[model samples]
Target: MAARERLADDPSITFPGFFDDTAVQTDADGGVVELTGALLRAVEVAADDFLGPQDANTLCVDRHESHRYRVVRRQGIIFIRIDEDPRACGLTVPALHSGAQYAIGSDGRILRRLRDGEPDGSLAPTDAGSGIPVPTSEVGRSFEAPDGAVPLPF
Candidate 1:
């Protein structure tokens, strides 16, 4: 039966808290517990498992204040990208990354990193579309960033 098959495939899952170097207060006696480096790393590993396979196309987090962050997987990997106005100093940039280990900055700058044993600057952006993936503001028309900004290819 389809239901039987689904149940068979589903496995038990556990979730680890994702708070590194974060302090926790104990209700009893107002005790404070601080997560150190090792504990933090362990938490990260455990959190990864709970978050599901890295190959998952999407990962979302919703908070109490209606603040939500969605980490979408493009191919496999995900990077924390920070983007902001190039001229702004105190910028509240969003961290968005594709599975390619690359990021898009709020300032419209693209960030890429090379893997181990490889040259850092050797990475190149092949034109997935007709041309490069930069937004254009010509003819004085309303516009948004180029489609390249999206994780999914157009």
Candidate 2:
């Protein structure tokens, strides 16, 4: 049975429990199980399917008209460096350009936005002006910037 179906059928069965009970066969010697090679790949596939893709870029790409964004995922958050200048393709910091960078959740909600290495005050409100609240725990944490990219100031 598929993992999703198993979870739906049995509310008490966690993902690990489901995997332990059904995903792999135990060794006859001592009932030990090891995840390696094909098994590891299968686990990854199942995880991606169950929890959705880890990268927020796949979720947020459709919202942008340009595909010149660089995505970096760290600690369940996604950082996107948007290249606004058409000539700046493959370049990290466009010269005197007005591109913006964003820290977004895996679910594609904007957490923070930066312009020209500073906080962008012109950010619009979301969810009928209530705006999305930035989680305090997510604030001040340093996310690894993409290669040749400047780190966000948040």
> Best candidate, TM-score-wise?
2
Q: How does model 1 fare in lDDT? A: 0.30
- The whole-model lDDT of each prediction reads 0.30, 0.42
Residue 87 C-alpha lDDT in model 2: 40
Task: Report the Cα lDDT for residue 140, model 1.
Answer: 62
Off by over 4 Å in 2: 1-67, 88-95, 117-154
Q: Per-residue alpha-carbon lDDT of model 2 for 22-103, expressed as tens digits?
A: 3333425778665444333333333333234455564332223323444444565454455443342444553554454555
Runs in model 1 deviating more than 4 A are 1-33, 53-57, 61-154
Judged by lDDT, which candidate is best?
Answer: 2
Q: Give residue 61's error in model 2 in angstroms.
A: 18
> Using Cα atoms with residue i matched to residue i, what is each candidate's TM-score against the true structure?
0.18, 0.29
Model 1 lDDT tens row, 1-154: 2211211111111111223334333334867756445333332332332233344344323111112212222332222211222223332542342111222222222223222233334335566777655546554664676676667554
Q: After superposition, how far is residue 35 of candidate 2 from its true place, in Å?
A: 25
